[model samples]
Target: MNTNTGDDKSFLNRLSSIVEANLSDEHFGVTELADKLRMNRSSVHRKLKSITNKSVSEFIREIRLQKAKGLLEEGSDNVSEVAYNVGFGSPSYFSKCFHDYFGYPPGEAKNHTKTESDPIELTEEGKTTKTFKQPSRMILVVIAITVLLGAYLVYQKLSGNPSEKSVIVLPFKNLSSEESTQYFADGITEDILTQLAKISDLQVVSRTSSEQFRETALSSPEIAGKMNVNFILEGSIRRQNDNVRISVQFIDARHDRHLWSENYDRQLADIFAIQSDIAKNVAKQLQTILSPEEIKQIEKLHPKNAEAYDKYLMGQYLCLKRDSISIRKGIEYFNQALEIDSTYTLAYSGLADGYYALSFTGYIDRKIGYARAYEMAEKALDMDSTLAEAYAVLGIVSKFGYWKWEEARKYFEKAIEVDPNCMVAHLYYCSFLDIVGEPDKAFEQVNRAIELEPYYHMTFRMKGIILCDEKRYEESNEALKRSYELNKESYYNYSRIFLNYLALNDEAAALEKLRELFALRPEYLEYKNDITPLYESSGINSVLKMFLDARLELGNEDDHFLIPILATKLGMQNEALTYLEKACAEKTRDIPRMIRKPELEVLYSNPRFVALVDTMNLSPYFQKLSE
Candidate 1:
């Protein structure tokens, strides 16, 4: 019994006794234990719920987590041994739960398995300020109840029976006549996902993983079979003017039985309260413990405007495109949201995404846009620092905005610490490391993401880019091809592979690939000139000009100066002077990229080419090499 709430003393005492005696038993669960307790099964469940604020099963999982912690602290038994001893039968399952609970690799938490060195810090500042600022009194109370419950499930997943502790949030439907308002339902679905992410006790699967169920015509048992969740939440959201209606049902997937059902209808202003109610009720139905602070987080309210939020949802839809046009459109709506409400933290996050995406594609003026990205991300953090989306935004800012790799990794790590199943944090951070030439570790993380959300095409593309950069063009091309096959509308599906094939010097293969690529998009430059880095030619200047001239029909023929610059490198002085005159009038994106191209190396000693570079404002490359 909680000392403060002595009213449920007998119940907590009963729960503690049952756990200490039979945790090592493999088949232990509510019915078996309730039978042994000599009370009605429902009565035993009721008493346990009242005292511990968790279900009989969650209480059991908590016991397992506590025991696993003891073993982790002791550093004695191997992970599998500890896992089985606690009741879990599988070693891999235990590691997954460990990651979800503590926000670290099981090996790292074990204190012996060294990953990399500690990441560099963002500042000398202590723990985040937002962790302390927001408080939801009722929500906090619910959090304590749920965390204790979830902690038990984590424990069970580690040591106890896996059958009793897992849960999955289903894709909530819109049940409305309008298909366009589906984003509202999806937003509610995602909000529930995010709220569950805060508990830290349960292994909340990411939205991408769960969204696979959106098209499912399966029953609770069938859905649970695929999701591997013991419990499931299904709901629908309806918005008609200022009135918002949400209907939800919870099921014990093991028996395909309804455990709880409720419908809520409220005004626009009551949306936050509605969210809180849904979370609290779900926690109650699952019979999980929630900590006070966590409850507060779930219940914390920001200003609500249904119309503006709808636009923000649209922004989310577009931002996920990660393309030039979609990114711009996402920002347009995000700004529209902020115009409607000054304190919309999520809108600021969307705006930050637009700026970050712009810089990522190399279309924006990096100096100013990168600065704006950091500023907006900072503002987002200030408004709601606990937001995992905001932290992920900071991760991008640290990378592109600050050019601080270590700092960016720290922010990503921090964001994942707050929400281990954060798909974007995992996906983008892995890409950052891959871009820096750490393909092995990047591959490891991207693989983890695939395991977590195998259905998402972007994850495939992200990892495929790394493979291309590593010169594993076969594997890279294959992965991108797979992603493209899955979603033909995926715009940059072959962007990386296109350059990789060229690098392999397979001209006929490249040309064949280009036909297929052109069939899908009318614009060639979108994928060729922007997304993938295309090299100059075979390691020599004169050869490079000839190479460039040979590929003139491939859309870079207008690059007049490039040919002359290459001619100067090969000692063709007259050719260099002539081409140099033509190049000065050419405007090309490749101009800024030429400094890094290897074929231009021979022209370094040529005075005319040097003068041409100076006139064309190519001093940066010379300066870069010098520095």
Candidate 2:
């Protein structure tokens, strides 16, 4: 019989309902469940813990396991099929968890009988909460010993022995009196992550993914479960003038065991040493043997001067803001860092990144931005031949700036070879694959980027864009919605969502998203008067025509490639081909990306379009990569 109060029972029922609803979605976790419950994650976690004494993940997994058990008993599916049906991504993992939870393996569940208590608990006390009513003393003793031993073995299996080394380093707390020191703390965390990521055997979650927990109330174990990692690294930083204090702790989040921790109090100049020590210690604790190259990469320090490094960190912090002004300001800081030490490879790379951002976002002239970016990247590479970022920047220049498609591929591959965990390389390569008409390879590359930084908004945005290009409108919108939820202020997500709506012929939804996007980006608001009435009268094509007009009126030489895309959507085949010919003749930066859109699929058999694509020499490389 159930022992819970009415409120507790109802709450548990509602929680179960939510979990069961999303049982097949492996990405559905504590946060998504909390959102469905219309409560903060902390509130849901605390209330559920008080009732069940199990973490949210344990609760969700229990529901999945219960459904899997029922399915198995019904003899409806094989173990692998049932595992996927019940939200487990790996059949072996499901079997292990099933055995741990139910005391019998999934295979034996077909003939096994359940004798546990009504109020199921995940803890050891759950094993004996309710026993046989009138068992003999000798039998009771034997059962008790067996249960204790079984519990011990399960505990040892789950907590004592570890698996493949994977970890998420949460954002470090900034304890400095000055709030501005937060950037320094973040830079420290990022550098440590970089060092750890250099080790091929260690899987380190990127800073963008781990940064989501900066103000979270969840426990380390909960975070670990959400990130699908077994360990967590957390720290606090306090900086004052020339002195800094950093306290770092490494934990086996699964067992809640503190594997190692240390406090470092040193001058600002010793930060490099501190970062290296932390990475080395983490690797040591994990019993990972670092290759010589990984050791060298971790130990390499830059700008020897503390002040120069400080400016570089500031540049990185600002550039992450991703706005035109902040990016330009970041460039200034990078330049300042280089003035202090002209040989600082990272500062040059930072400059290249800033210019790349400016060019990519159309904040600067394409030629000027790419030229400066290329120069800075080359300089950085000359100083540090092993710099993965330099190679990635060169790849960007080769692809979008020069249209040297094969050269771009080599650069991106080399970047990944230099640093297997280079998210930039993976991301840019994803776009390259898509441009070459290899959507499957593009999907794989983008998914790899998502794995490295699951919480990043851009990765999902890219996925949405790819899906939309494939005419998978509903799936595209789902990915775009996730991207929007991650960063509501990002107009890019709004734009992509509306584009998907347009593709789906949902003009009303498209208009709504357009309005939201224009609200975020007021510059686009100037065209509202010209568009809204036409949109109501003639629908999405009219809106696209007005946007095309606006783009033409802007007289931006770099954006001429957009003319063909809009023209193609309106079924103006001759106009699209003519403008595309001009765009190709003028060597527009975006022409390659625009030509591959599904809207232009009508031109696949057109002689002019075929000739244009042939001139670009894309098909051979597409076949090469697809092979």
Best candidate according to TM-score: 2
- How large an RMSD does model 1 have? 27.8
Checking candidate 2 for backbone clashes, the offending pairs are none
* Lowest lDDT 10-residue stretch of candidate 2: 135-144
- Tens digits of per-residue lDDT for model 2, 71-140: 9999889999999998887787788678656644688677666552122111221111222221111000
lDDT value for candidate 2? 0.72
Give per-model TM-scores.
0.55, 0.64
> What are the C-alpha RMSDs, in order, of all predicted structures?
27.8, 23.1
Q: CA lDDT, every prediction? A: 0.60, 0.72
Give the alpha carbon lDDT tens digit for every residue of 527-613 in model 1.
Answer: 333222232333323334433433232322333334544454456667656554453434222233333333355666667667766
Model 2, TM vs. native: 0.64
Residue 231 displacement in candidate 2 (angstroms): 2.3
